[model samples]
Target chain A: MNGKYRFLLAALPLAVVIGLSGFFYDRLGKDPGELPSVLIGKPVPEFTLPGLEDGAPGLASADLRSGTVTIVNVFASWCAPCRIEHPMLTALAKVPKIRLVGIAYKDKIEATRAFLGELGNPYALIGADVTGRVAIDWGVYGVPETYLVSPGGEIVWKHVGPLDETVIRGELLPRAEKLLK
Target chain B: MKFLLRLSSPRRRPGPFAGRVPLSARDPGLRRDDARGWRALALATVLFLSAVPALAIGVDEPMADPAMEAKARDIARGLRCLVCQNQSIEDSNAPLAADLRHIVRERLAAGEDEAAIQKYLVDRYGEWVLMRPPFEPATYALWFGPAALLLTGVGVILWRRRHPATVPEAEALTAEERARLDRLLKDEDPA
Candidate 1:
C-alpha cells in the first residue's frame, strides 16, 4: 500500500477503538437504579405498621379492604411535597365513597402529629413508619407516593410523587371509581 | 617477513573505494539486517498501541468496601448530580456528588428508609436530582426520546447505506475540449 493509504488504513481501527472506548465508558458509569420502572400496574409491596394516633388501631393490608376505596399516602413530616399535596389530600378525603390514610415515613410521632395539627388532618387513619422500614417495604422512592388500594385490598394504582388537584379529578378519581365498583 | 608484511599491508586503502564503504561492507549477512530492524519497529508499535485503554480502566482508586461501594454506586445511578447533565452522581467525583453520596450513607446508617433518603434529596434539591425524571406530561419527551432517536438513527443509516451516487448525464462537450481530446486520441494534434 502507498504510505498515506497505509497510515489511513491503520488509523481507521484506532478511530473505531476510540469510539468504542467512549461508548463503553459512557455506559459503564450509568446508574442502574434509574432503569425505567417495570412495576407499573403491579401489586404494591405489602406493609403493616402502627397507626400514628395514640390508642388508635395500627394499619394493615386488610384495612384497605373495608368496603371503601382508600388512598394510602406515603408522606414524611419533612417532605415539602406532602405539604403541597395536603389540601388535595383533604379534598380527596371529603370525596364520598373514598377514604384517605397517611403513612408517616421516617418521622417522629410527635412531629407527625404536630404537622397534621398545623396543616389540618386529612387522613382517617395515620400510620407511623418511624424507622422508614415500611416505606422501603412499599418500594417507595420518595413521597408523597399515593397508592389507590381497591376495596379488595389490591394496590390497583400508585401515584409516585406529590398529588395535585388535577391528579385527583382526572387520573385518581377516574381509576378509583372503576375499582370502587 | 615479506609474507607477513603482505598480509598486514594497507596498500588497498588508497584506492577509489576509500570513502564508499564502512566496516560493515565486510559482512553480506548484515546487509539484510535493515529489513529485520523495520520489522522490529513495526512489532513494537503494534504492541504499544494495544496497551493504552486496558491500562486506563484499571487505574481507578480502589474502594474500601466494594459491596457498599456497589450499593452507593446503585443509589448514585438513580441520582443526577446537579452540576452535570450526562453523568450519574455515583459516577461523578464532583464535590457536590461526593457530599450527596456521604449524605446517602448517613441516611442509610441512621436506619432511614431508602425511599425516605431519596425523598429527602428530592425535597432538598428538587426533582431535578432524580436520574429518571418522574413520568408526567411535562416529561413526556424525555421518557420517549430514546425510542424516537433509535428509530430516526436506524432510518438514516439504512437510507445512507442503500442510496448510490448518481452518475452525471453526458454533457454537451465544449467544442475546444472535444477537438483537443479527438486530436490526442488520433495522434494528430492538427490544431
Candidate 2:
C-alpha cells in the first residue's frame, strides 16, 4: 500500500469508533418511555363509552369532529401520574374552543367520582372504560397518556407519559394555539 | 502428572488452603491441558444452544378449539409486548401483553385471519409491534447492513492477504562471519 493509503488503513479503528459513537449519540437523548404513535395523522377510532357516572355526559369519537380541536386525556384513579398531572389538565380545560375530555381507564365508577371529587373535575365528558377495550382501540399501553386531535378528528400529537408544565406549554399549547387561530 | 490430569474435578472440592496445586502455573509444556479446556468449551456451547428454546416463555390459556388455539399461538408469537420490548406478547406476563392476547383471541374467534388481526395491530402500534419488521425502504439498511459489513470485511482481509507489506532484504554475511558461524555450528558440549 502507498504511504498515504497506509495512513487511511491505520485510522480505520478510530473511524469505526467515531461512527459507532455518533450513531448511539444520536439515539441517546430520546426518552425510551416515549414511543412514536402510528395513530398520528389518522382519524380517532370510533366508539361510544358509557359515562363514568349516570348523569355525566359520556365521551365519543363523534364529539371530537364538531369542528374543534380536542385534547383526550387517558387516565385512571389508580395511576399516580394522573394525580400529578391533574392540575395541568384542569388548566387545559379552561382554554376556550379546545375541548378537553377524559377517559377513566379500567377504574370503577365510584372510584372515578371519588377521584374527581378529591382532585376536582376538569373533564367536560368522562368515559367509563372498565375493561380498557376503548383504550386498546386508542392504542394506549399505559395510563396518563394525552392525545391532541385535529378539528377534523385526526389525531395530531401524543405525549406518552405524564404531562408537565414544559410539555404542555412548549408542545401541547403551541400546536393547539395554531389550530385555535 | 497423573494427579494434575484430573482436570474434571470440582473446583470447590480443593479449597484455597487445601490442595494448593496451581497446575497451570506448575506445568509449562503440558499441551494436553488445552484439550480438556476445548472439550469443556464445546460441551458448554452445546448446552447453551439446546437451552435457547426453553428460554422462550410459555403462552397463556389456549382456545377451546385445538386448531384455533394453535393459530392464535402462531399469531401471538409474531406480536411484540409493548411493556417489555424484547418479549413477544405470547411470552410476556405484562398486563398490556395479556390485553393484546385477549384482543387477538377475540378477533380470531370473530373469523378474522392472522394477517387481518396483525394488520389491525400494526395500524395502531406501527411496524414496531411486529417481531419482524416489514421490508421497506426505511428498514432496507437494517436488513442488509450485517451481510454487507461481513462481505466488506472479507474483501478487506483478502485484499490485505493479496498485497502483503514488503519486507527489507538482509545484507549477505562477510567471509569472517561465515567462518565463525560454521565453527559455532560444529562445537557441541555434552551435559
Most accurate candidate by TM-score? 2
Candidate 1 C-alpha lDDT tens digits along A1-181: 3579769979999999999999999889455433233334555456677977667886776677677888889888888988988888888888888889878987899999899989998888878888765665565656678888787676776777788877778889999889867
Q: Taking the tens digit of each residue's C-alpha lDDT, what string does model 2 give over B96-185?
A: 888899889999999999889999999888889999988999999999999999999999899889988778799899999999888888
For candidate 2, the docking band is: medium
The prediction achieving the highest lDDT against the true structure is: 2
Q: TM-score of chain A, model 2?
A: 0.92
Name the DockQ score for candidate 1: 0.02
lDDT scores of the candidates, listed in order? 0.72, 0.86
For candidate 1 chain A, which ten residues in a row score worst on lDDT? A32-41
Give one digit per residue, the lDDT tens place, for model 1 in B7-96. 344342324664476534754544355455556668878889878645432323434666655665577679887556578766665544
| Best prediction by DockQ | 2
The complex in candidate 2 yields a DockQ of 0.64
lDDT of 1 at B174: 100
Off by over 4 Å in 2: A11-14, A17-21, B1-61, B169-191
- Provide chain B's TM-score, model 2: 0.59
